[model samples]
Target: MRLIAAGLLLFGTLAPTLAIPPPTKPPCCPRHEVFTECGSSCPATCNSILERNANRVCPDICVRGCVCREGFVRNRDGKCIPPDRCGRDGHRPGDSSEEESGIRCHRPNEVFSECGSACPETCDSIVKGGSERKICTKNCVIGCTCREGYVRNADGECVLPEECPRHESSEESTKCAPNEVFSECGTACPDTCANLDDPKPRPCTRNCVIGCICQEGFVRNDEGQCVLPSQCPNSDAIASSSLLLAPLPECGPNELYNECGSACPETCDTFNGLVENRACILLCVPGCFCKDGFVRSKDGQCIPPSECPKPTGSTPTIEIITPECAINEVYSQCGSACPATCETISGRSPPRVCPAVCISGCVCRAGYVRNAAGKCVPPYECESNPECGPQEVYRECGSACPPTCRNVLNPNLEIACIDKCVAGCFCRDGLVRHHNGKCVSPKQCRIPIGIFTVGSSEELNAE
Candidate 1:
């Protein structure tokens, strides 16, 4: 009981001295509308802007640490005043209590925020170009840089079209024209048709070894390749084999079959002689005598055409001088002084005839004709193709461009595929073949052809 009495006395005496002023509203917002004074009933019309916002008890009804009153906001007496006297309300852009702040949430490469004062629709954020974005939308025909998971459509703006699915390759929409392809990454060409079966290596496919659209060994080079072994750049190992074998053979082409099979025996050894395995070759057998310009050796060898001297009318003196005469003695092309009747050489031989020297004969490579010079050369058109002048008399092989037409790029160009001459025909681009004498280069076009000019779209298509 004595302690209670002392506590009552202490409360009574110190209550007056400790009396504190009623709470006021924080300066961030107008006190009349949102903040309420302690112990005061929040007025129903504290601020006309917010009516029902004031009806609750003071201190707990509105914004924390704020004070509110009737018509006159919490004035100097911590009470309401006339409505006209109230200052501005609500938070500005960067108020500490403001929920939405200066930061703007935008999509990648978007310029919703603001570049200086204008809206950059086509900002390229990654490259830091103008607005840091490129416009991608139907409205913008110039096209725009698209954000992730999207691509630019024909409309020119960034939009998600079903045709271009996510994570799919761009080849579906990007294409090149024939004789063309994407120059760089992301570019498109209409002609993607590449040769699929090149048995030999070429440059375009980047030294591809197998399964290319353009032939097996060939590839689409930056410059394109249509020729033979030359397709591969110089020192291109694909041109030759490791054992010094000739280039790979493409058989039945232009009816020229040199080195046709796998690997034919290069030497004239009897054991390795195989007619089926022979390449483009024509050989003189061991028993048959060479026509001319061939020599017989003491060891029974047929000297090559290159090694033999010119064929003279008479027999060689070396065989019949002291050497025993045989019905099949090796005869060579060493005779010029003796008569053509297998006569003897005056200085060295008795009246004996000459024989063959080649136990093993010689053969010629493919692609050459047996001329009077007895040398091989590219197949000639002869009288069959008068169009093939001296400049390009060699006939196109049956395997390359067909007998129809062949158009070769200039040799000086980095990329050139087929040679200029065809098997037996030729023509220029965009020309139709009819009963004309022959298709010609633009130099021989028959018509003074050209498009007629028109003033408008309707006028052009109609006529």
Candidate 2:
């Protein structure tokens, strides 16, 4: 429903003749006041997707201007937003600390990712020093060498991995950078919260949440509050938390909690349970859990068993997350070892053996050339390294394994074929070398690296 104001003012500040029209069949009623002026009629002048997009976002229309709708958000152009987020926080959405702050955020967040994505909106400084923050990415596969103030952890979280235990020997003072957050942890700031007025700094201090502290001299009063102007030497200290000093951006126009000053929910599950991570959950209330053998989660509420059962079928598909992939690790069950391989990251579970097993609906891992049996097999040999090298002997001829392989990919495995099997070329052509067996065009067979012998000089006759 395009808006038609109730108890509102403004005889006609807006001129619909120039205003953007609402969508076709916009939901009747329940539409807010901001969109009221947007007119219920469709605008024949614009594209239909624009009409639909505008209506889809009409929920974010602020009665005032083009702000976001209550509980919803808008972008710079005043478009509707995603749950508890802006476009991109520029931080790994998976990082733990980034999430906790999301909890303390304003909206349910589970429904608003397009608004509150990044933080601080500004930083004291973003310095680039020695590579102490090892960024584990495709660009730096071997092992990232991070810069100062950042350390690479096992799971590859570039954090303050190790802190030189406070030297009891010397009670010297540690200086904080100009505006850099410095605590016992490290110098890197918090979610760089888009909300900056939060005078007391809270970074990934304790565990992962934002740990707030009173300014230098002031201590927390009993009310769990810190009276700034009266308590601190400087008046500008507590001026933050105030709307005037730190106005929550009018960015999200109609959003209910846009500037409400509270964190949002992290993740949700319709069934098993909203994770303990951000206290972000909402299921079947106190009455809902899963109905027995069936399971329900935020994503799937009450999934019946046998809908797609069988874990060993040629194209097996399970009801939910499979058993293998239950353990915390990465790249466990693709046919051959490679950087990327899974159809889905089943969170934590036992590895799914390929060729004979799959999570039912999940796609086959990469590097595996599906066999006639439909089981996933390595692109090369399907046997252990011992068959190709030494300790690789005990290696099983199956997919999925514990994360303990010292070196991945057997170097002695069958080589990449340019055209067809080389032996086939030799046997059919009287043992003469035929780059490839497939009697095809010469351009198809690429030259092999490091394999051309000195005496084998024979070029196809040309003009």
Candidate 3:
């Protein structure tokens, strides 16, 4: 009678839908690929499936109706006992948890995403020279490759693909002239080379054909061959021979780096955080910069120093040991007054310094505005207002502002507001802030947009 009851329990657990007799060994049941499919008969005490046992070595049999779930075995007294509760002395030699079996690789970026011997095979395939890391994606596909921004070189060291110089014997070498060298596969190499300080030196092209370019201090001659810098008429070598230096043209008002220094002069390092990669110390073709936030006026006049934008928490605080300015160039300061240069050129009111700490810089040209790309483009060229991010639009000096962000200073105010101007990007009228710090439309927004007061139009026009 006891034997019959135990057999009935096993049968019910395996096939509650069917009333067939319990088999001697578990059958190859349909696999539960998802956790939701693995249902529990008694969810309160025992789990329906052992997550560890959900792999290939274990059969995809059900333990739903009466028997205990996987990671558990029936005791002599007919009670389900966890693997830990089972005495080690009573346990058989082969009986062990999946984790104890030592088949899984617990390395970072590597996971056992699926049930199969295939994962083990993939792990084994990782020979010394092969992929250093292997990851199982969410879809259970094994992604074996080098880390981000790194490619395996011929020596098998995970180095930058660009830093690995191409030799004449390489496949890319045949595409270039005998005098030219293969720079990269589908990249834009510099047309003229100088020892300019490049923060990011990489290929700019996106073709698979590979690029052939001249080396540094060299230029492509009319014969399509690389020649020495001096040989090229337009090379404009700053240093003549060993000692003499070429005189730089005097820069007009509000310019920086119009002349050459002994080495690359450090400029734009401070503005990197406020404006992404806007300034750089260059060795070749140095000129005056309008700073990151400032743009030259259309009439070739500079904006007053006081009218520049302010730096924010996002702005990096880098200290340059020697802050050098070019001839007629103004040293950048926190609150330097702007020159009335634009007023004389455009006959408009002198622009005030952009509000915020360390926001001062050169003014933009008339009829043109600086876009996110940092290019001085016509006002109409700005298709949409500057996007602080997705779902955020620029709020002009007089435009309606969002309520949540009220009384808060915006980091990216377009036009300086002394009395009447409103500035910076804001969430759209119908949009609101989401929990993730992103502005979202009505559907995804947790804080729904509602009635809110904005700055009065009359007050805005009063300025």
Per-residue lDDT of model 3, residues 107-187, tens digit only:
333333323322233212322223233453322222233444554455444455455554445565457665566653433
Better of 1 and 2 by TM-score: 2
Q: Order the candidates by TM-score, highest first — what do you get? A: 3, 2, 1
- Which run of 10 residues does model 2 get worst, by summed lDDT? 421-430
The lDDT of each candidate is 0.29, 0.27, 0.38
The runs of at least 3 residues in candidate 1 whose Cα sits more than 4 Å from the true structure, single-residue gaps closed, are 1-156, 160-215, 220-222, 226-229, 233-238, 241-463
Off by over 4 Å in 2: 1-171, 185-362, 365-377, 381-463
Q: Pick the candidate with the highest TM-score.
A: 3
What's the distance in Å from true for residue 78, model 3?
32
| Backbone clashes counted, model 3 | 24
RMSD of 1: 40.8
For residue 8, give model 2's deviation from the true position in Å.
66
For every model shown, what is its TM-score relative to the native structure?
A: 0.15, 0.17, 0.21
**Candidate 2 accuracy as lDDT:** 0.27
lDDT of 2 at 363: 35
Q: Which candidate tops lDDT?
A: 3
